[model samples]
Structure formats: structure tokens, C-alpha cells
Target: MRLSRRDALAALVAGGVGSLAGCGAPTARSSPSSREAAGDAAETPVGDHELATLVAVAEAVYPSEVEGVGEFVRTYTGSRVEGAGSYARGVAEAVGTLDDYAAEFHDIEYASLPASTRRETLEYMSVDDVAPDPDGTEAQRVRHYLVNELLYALYTSPTGASLAGLENPPGHPGGTRSYREGPDA
Candidate 1:
């Protein structure tokens, strides 16, 4: 078949228009369900809604009390960067699972009980007086994540620096002055 010049140009325009239309749709990288988009925010094994709720609760409890808590968490969520560890998520999982710990002690969910009861439940759990159940995997996971090790690291981090008031140059004076000589020349 023979084609005219005007028809050829019209066909090329139609092809260009189709290509532009396809480009407007999202690519794999931009899809809502794409793994790239999910990253650490949605990578946890826990349910998405539950994880979000836990994150919110954690922010409330800690809330950049010192300064860098939120920034540190955001940085550490996935990379495991040397200084920025995933302590925030670990803490959230641990505290949110308080209900499981409560069940081990009082046979009830932590949130289901009165505030006083919840506090008491945590107190007992903290000291191991109630004996946490190793069989409950989630509860065990929570305890594992929220231990003294994590707390210690967080307290040492910049996020907790304000609480300790660790200044750049320590306020206390050195025992020996710069010009002080050996005690017994």
C-alpha cells in the first residue's frame, strides 16, 4: 500500500501521543505497593496498621525529648547506620506488646485494664516478678527488643544528650592544671 505525506505525519503524531499517555501512568518505582516506596516504613513484619499505630505511640512517649530521637529513628530504620540504630522500632514493638505481658501476669490485655492496672502490670513485668511467658513469641520478641541494652544505647545517643546535659566541653575542671608539674618533680 502507498501512503500520503499528510497521513504519515498524522500516524507519527498518534504514536507520540500514545507514548506520552503511557508515561503519565506510574512506573514500578512509583506504585503505591512498590517495595521501593515501602522501604523501612512498611518493611517490618508486623501488620502495617499496627506498626503505624505503634510508631505514633512511640513518638508520643519519647517525642524528641532530648532533640534527635525522631531524626535518629528516621535515619536508622533500614540502614543500621553505625550511630543510628533501629532502636525506635524496637522500643515501639516492646511497649505496644504490653498487653501480652499483662496477659502473662493478670490474664488480661494491658489496654483492656484500668490505667492503674496497666501501670502495675508493667511494674511487675519490669522486675520479672510475674514471669514472662517465653512461649508467647510476640511477648518474647517485645522483651528482647526493649531491654536494658537498647535503653542504654538510646540514653547514650544524641537523643538522650539533653537529659544528661552532656556539654561539648565538660563543665567540671580537670584535676590537674595545664602548667601543673608532676607531684614529685
Candidate 2:
């Protein structure tokens, strides 16, 4: 099923994906100073190019049935990058690596490629074969910063959890009444 932006935001909040200083809200668009004021000392301002590249990567990785991939990825990845300096650097490096590869083989940036081409580029890079590792080789870093990161964000959200048949994923209370009901209910 297609998830609206509102649904995605609600799911993110329920999953505690972007709870900065008890704000319990998505802060993708929050300024650097605001994020710091909220106690996110590690908050790194992700560049627009990086975010656009991430959205492109998400389009390749996420299932076609999933909607609002851009906003969801931006919100989730933005929050994740904010929480860790190393992670932000890794994401930037990974995007650069992907772009370099795309330019070499496809004569274009990764984000400029069509979705199918982007997926093909990822497959050609062997991202799936490599384990996610921030300090590992290029493929591993891409898996860590791009592939695994996106997958983790998607699966952790309520909308994405439902894709895996998890009606009540961890962190999502789903209400006390849900506990008394059967899985099918």
C-alpha cells in the first residue's frame, strides 16, 4: 500500500526515529543551530546534493510499492547523520564514491541515472555482496552508508514494518488495545 507523507511522519514519530531532545518530531529541515540547541551536538548539516543522491539511492533500494521514499529517506537519514559525525562523513564519502563510479561507467552521476540504471549500477558495484562496514572497502562502505542505512530506516518505520508483516515493530506501542487483539485483528 502507498503511504502518505503524514503517515510516514506519524510512523517515524511512533518508531522514535527522530526524537531530538524529547521533541519527538522529524527535524530534517531544522537548521544546524536549532539542532545543536536541541542537544544534538554531533549534528552535521547534510548537503542538498548528498540528500538528493540518497533519495536516488533509496529509489533503487526500496520496493516499488513504497511511497514517499524521498521524504522518508531525508527525514530518517538526516536524523541519523545528525546523531553521529562519523556517519555523516561516511555518507558523504559514499555518495562521492557512487558518483565517481557512475561517471566512469555510465558517464553520469548516480543520481542522474534512471532508477533501473541506478539499480544496475549498484548491482555492478557488488554492494549486496559486501557487508556493511564504515571502515571497510568501497563496496562495504556503500553498503553501510547507503544500502543498509536506507533498509534499516525503512524497516524500523511503522509503514515499512508492515511490509515485513510486523504489525507492532519495536518502539511502536500500537496502543494498549492492540495487545489484546490477535495478529489478524
Candidate 3:
């Protein structure tokens, strides 16, 4: 039967709504269930939430008394484009994945947990197996995507170099040529 333009529009909208109502929950989930599970999730923009998550993870991994993740993350993640997207995106995704894993295992978010839980969780990642290259371990994954990157940034900075007893590390030149004393000093 023929209908007026307004009637046709109304009928179309009703049909669309009816079809949507019958649909159930999605059959397939794209996101990884844990850090161990690899699944496709749409890339989200990196922001403070992600950065805070990374800072927590980094501190847990390194357990530094004098250093924090802020300067290291800001410097390395600033200009470089690496991992997942930019350096910032890589840090965000790694931390997000870790949080996903924590929620799946403990029914709680990573940052919300106590410091002990975070440490145990990261250690647990080390032995989680994909076989072949040992790098597949969750620890390694965390290290590669989070810790090592942060460490590299930290150890190369003037402060970190001094801590490591190096005079003018590779990336950080310090002030003048003589700014750094020998290891004996």
C-alpha cells in the first residue's frame, strides 16, 4: 500500500527501532579479556587517565624511592612515535591492557588496588607463557611496553645517569663537557 511521505518516514523509523530491539548482546567481543588475551579493540586517544595508569604501573615495576614516572614518560612519550601508535599511545594501551587483566582476574581495577597487589600482578606476568621467545611473558610484555621504555628514558636523563654512576650518558649530555666527574668521584 502507498503512504504519504510523512507516514513513510514514520514507518521506516518504527521498523528500525523494532529491528534493534530484537538484537541481543554482541556475540563476539573484540577487546582482549586480559593482558594475556590478544583481541582487537579500537584505539582510544591517550589522556590523563591512561597516563596515570602508566605512572602507577611504572612505579610498581621500578619501585623507585627518588624517581617518578612523570619526567621520564613526558620526555620519551613526547616526540617519539613508537608502539601501537605514538609513544604516548603505546604507554596508554599497555597500561589499559594491564588494567583489563587486573579487572578480569581480581574484579577490581589496577590503580584502585593496594601496592602489594600491583607488584604481585606484575610479577605474575613474567611467567605467563606464549613460549618461544621469553619476551612473550607478561613480565616481558610489561617490561617492553612499559618498564624498559620508561627505564631507558630515566637512565638516559642527567639525574638517572648520575644515579647509575655515569658521566654524561648517551642521550643526556649534562651541562658542559666537564660537568660530569669520573666514576671514581
State which candidate has the highest lDDT: 2
- Candidate 3 overall Cα lDDT vs. reference? 0.49
Q: By TM-score, is 1 or 3 better?
A: 3
Compared with the true structure, what per-residue lDDT tens digits does model 1 show for residues 30-88? Answer: 12222223546644423333333333323433434434433333323212211212333
Instruction: Indicate whether candidate 2 or candidate 3 has the larger lDDT.
Output: 2
Q: Give the TM-score of each candidate.
A: 0.33, 0.76, 0.58
- Sort the candidates on lDDT, descending order: 2, 3, 1
How many residue pairs collide in each prediction? 0, 0, 1
TM-score of predicted model 1? Answer: 0.33
In model 2, which runs have C-alpha deviations exceeding 4 angstroms? 4-45, 171-180
Model 3, span 123-142: residue lDDT tens: 66662332322124444455
* Candidate No. with top TM-score: 2
* Candidate 3: residue 128 lDDT (0-100): 31
| Local error of candidate 1 at residue 14 (angstroms) | 54
Per-residue lDDT, model 3, residue 105, is: 86
Off by over 4 Å in 3: 1-44, 67-87, 127-139, 175-180, 183-185
The superposed Cα distance between candidate 2 and the true structure at residue 116, in angstroms, equals 1.0
The window of 10 residues in a row where model 3 has the poorest summed lDDT is 20-29
Single out the weakest 10-residue window by summed lDDT for candidate 1. Answer: 23-32
